[model samples]
Target chain A: MPFVNIRITNEGATTEQKQRLIKGVTDLLADVLGKNPKTTFVIIDEVDTDNWGIGGESVTEIRKK
Target chain B: MPFVNIRITNEGATTEQKQRLIKGVTDLLADVLGKNPKTTFVIIDEVDTDNWGIGGESVTEIRKK
Candidate 1:
C-alpha cells in the first residue's frame, strides 16, 4: 500500500480539483512503480497560509510582499 | 527534519486539539528519531467521512452499520 499526501495553500480549491489530484497521483504511482490503485491512499491537506512556513517566514507573511 | 502527517476522520476536532497533535507528534519524533523540532513538519488532515474509504466502502457508508 502506498500513502500519498498533497499539501496546498488553502486558496479556495474546488472539490473537483482535489479529486483530480488524488486520481493523478494514484495513477502516477501505479504507472511508475507498479502500485495497486485499490491499495493506494491519497490525502489532500489544505493548510492555512499562516500555518505554512518557508525560509522561517509563514506563507501569510511572505505573501504580503 | 521530518515531515509527519496524521489523518483522521473529520469529527469536529477543535483548534487546540489539532495544535496538541502537532506538538505531540513533533516531540515524539524528536525523542525517538532525534529529529529537529524546529524543522519538523506536522500536518493533520481532517478528512470528510465521505472521502475516506476502507474496503471499497466510504467511512460514511461503513458507519451505517
Candidate 2:
C-alpha cells in the first residue's frame, strides 16, 4: 500500500481540486512505480500560512514582504 | 532534515496534544534516525471522517454501520 500526503497552504482549495490531485498522484505512482490504486491512499492537508516555514521564516512573514 | 506528517481523525485534538505529537515525533526521529530537530518539520493534519477511506468505504460510512 502506498500512502501519499500532499501539503498546501489553506488557499481555499475546492473539493474538486482535491479530487484531481488525489487522482493524478495515484495515477502517476501507478504509472511510474507500478503501484496499485486499490491500496493507494492520498491525503491532502491544508496548512495555515503561519504554520508553514521556509528558510528560517514562516510563510506568513515571507509573504508579507 | 526530516519531515514528519501525522494524519489523524479530526476528533477534537487540542493544540497541546498536537504540540506534544510534534515534539515527540521530532525527538523520536532524532533519537532513532539521527535527524536534526532544527531542520526537521512536523506537520499534523486532522482529516474529516468523510475524507478517509478504508476497505473501499469512507470512514464516515464505516462508522455509521
Candidate 3:
C-alpha cells in the first residue's frame, strides 16, 4: 500500500483540530490507496514555526507579519 | 519540504532491526532531503501477512510451506 505522511507547523491548529486532521487524512488514504482502514498508516508531525518555511518565508516570520 | 514514508510487511525483521530501520531511514532523509534531523518525521507500518502481497504471492503463503 502507498504510504502517506504529513508534516506541518502546529501554528494554527488546536489539539482537537490536529486529531481530526489525522483521522481525516488517514481515512482518505485508506480509501484512495486501497488499503484497510486498520492497515493504513499515517503519521503527522507538528513542527515548530521557526523550523518550517515556504517560498523563503519562515512560518514564524509569515505568521508574525 | 518533500515528505518520505515507507510501509513494509514486518515478516523478516526483529524488533531491534525495525528500530534501526526507522533511525537509518530518518537519518538518510535528513541528509538527502535537507531537513533537520529533529524536524524530519518517519512512520512505519507493519502489515499483516495475509493483507500484503507482491507479484501475486501473499506474504504468508510464500513464507509457508
Candidate 4:
C-alpha cells in the first residue's frame, strides 16, 4: 500500500482547511489512481515553524536573519 | 506541487531494484492520476536498518532483543 504523508510547518491553518486538504488528497489518490483508501494510510504531521528548513537554512532563524 | 517521497529502511537492495521501484511509483502516480513527474518530486531515501523503528522499537535493536 502506498502511504501519503504531508508534513506542514504552518500553524495558522484552520481545521476546515486541514480537513479539506486531507479529503482532496485522499480523493485524488483513490478516485484517480484507483487506490484503496482503507489500506492507503495518510498521515498529516503538523510541525512547528522552528523545526523546518529550506535551502539549507532554518525556517525560523533564517527568516529573522 | 505534490511530492511523493518513499523512505525505506532496507539498505540491502541493489541499484536496479531502487530504480525499478522509483519508475513504478512514478508511473503509477503519473499514468493513473495524470501527475506531472517533472514538477511532482519523488525522493527515495534509503535509510539504514539501525535508524528505523516500528511499534515504538528500533528495527536493528529490536531484532536482536
Candidate 5:
C-alpha cells in the first residue's frame, strides 16, 4: 500500500481542486510504481499561516512585512 | 521546522489520542532533530480499510477473511 500525504498552506482550496489532487497523485503512483489505486491512500492537510514557517518566520508574519 | 505526517488504520481513535500523537511527535522532532516546536507541523491521517492493503489484498478484505 502507498500512502501519500500532501501539506499545503491554508489557502482554501476548492473541493474540486482537492479531488483533482487526490486523483492525480493516485494515478501517478499507479503509473510509475504499478501501485494499485484501490489500495492507495491520499490525504491533504492545510496548515495555518501562523503555524507554518520558513526561514524562522511564520508565513503569516512574512506576509505582513 | 519539521512537517510530520502519520497514517494509521481508521479504527476510531479518540480526540485525546490524536492530540497526544501530535504533541508527542512534535516533542520528538524537537528533541532529536532540534526542530522548532513553534514551526513543527504534525498531521494524522486515518486510512479507511478499503483503501489500505498489503500483498495485493485490501485491509477490508483481509479483515473479512
Candidate 6:
C-alpha cells in the first residue's frame, strides 16, 4: 500500500482542488509504481500559518516580516 | 525542517493519544536526526477500513471473512 500525505498552508483551497489533488496523486503512483489505486491512500492537511515554520520562524511571522 | 505524517486505520483514538503522537514524532525526529522542533511538522491521518487494502483485498472486506 502506498500512502501519500500532502501539507499546505491554510490558504483556502476549494473542495474541487482537493479532489483533484487526491485523484492526481493516486493516478501518478499507479502510473509510475504500479500501485493499486484501491490500496493507495492520499491525505491532505491544511496547516495553520502559525503552526508551520520555516527557517526558525512561523509562516505567519515570516509573512508579516 | 522535518515533516512527519502518520497514517493509521480509523480506530477510535482519543484526542490525548493523537496529541501524544504529534509530540512523540516531533521529539523522535529531533533526537535522532537533530532536526529543529520549531520547524518540524507532524500530521496524522485516519483512513477508513474500507479504503485501506493489502494483498489485493480491502481491510474492510478482509475483516468480514
- Please write out the lDDT profile of model 6 over residues B23-54, one tens digit for every residue: 67777777899988877876566789999999
Give interface RMSD for all predictions: 4.0, 3.7, 10.4, 7.7, 6.7, 5.6
**Native-to-model Cα distance after best TM-score fit, residue B45 in candidate 2, in Å:** 5.7
lDDT of 5 by residue, A1-65 (tens): 69776788987776556666777887888889999887787666678999999999999999999
Cα error of candidate 1 at position A29, Å: 0.9
**Order of candidates by TM-score, top first?**
1, 2, 5, 6, 4, 3
Better of 1 and 5 by TM-score: 1
What is the clash count for each candidate, in the order shown?
0, 0, 0, 0, 0, 0
Model 1 TM-score on a 0 to 1 scale:
0.58
What's the residue-level lDDT of B10 in candidate 3?
A: 58
Model 6 scores a TM of 0.54
Question: Distance from true position, residue B51, model 3, in Å?
Answer: 16
TM-score of chain B of 3: 0.71
Residues B1-65, candidate 4, lDDT per residue (tens digit)?
A: 23556555564656766566556555554554454566455566666767777667777887687
Those runs of model 2 whose alpha carbons end farther than 4 Å from true positions after fitting are: B1-8, B11-45, B49-65
- Could you say which candidate leads in TM-score? 1
Best by DockQ: 2
Better DockQ candidate (2, 5): 2
Which scores better on TM-score, 1 or 3? 1
Native contact fraction, candidates in order: 0.02, 0.06, 0.19, 0.02, 0.04, 0.10
Cα RMSD (angstroms) for every candidate in the order listed: 6.5, 6.3, 11.4, 8.2, 8.6, 8.4
Off by over 4 Å in 5: B1-65
Candidate 1 CAPRI level: incorrect
Better of 4 and 6 by DockQ: 6
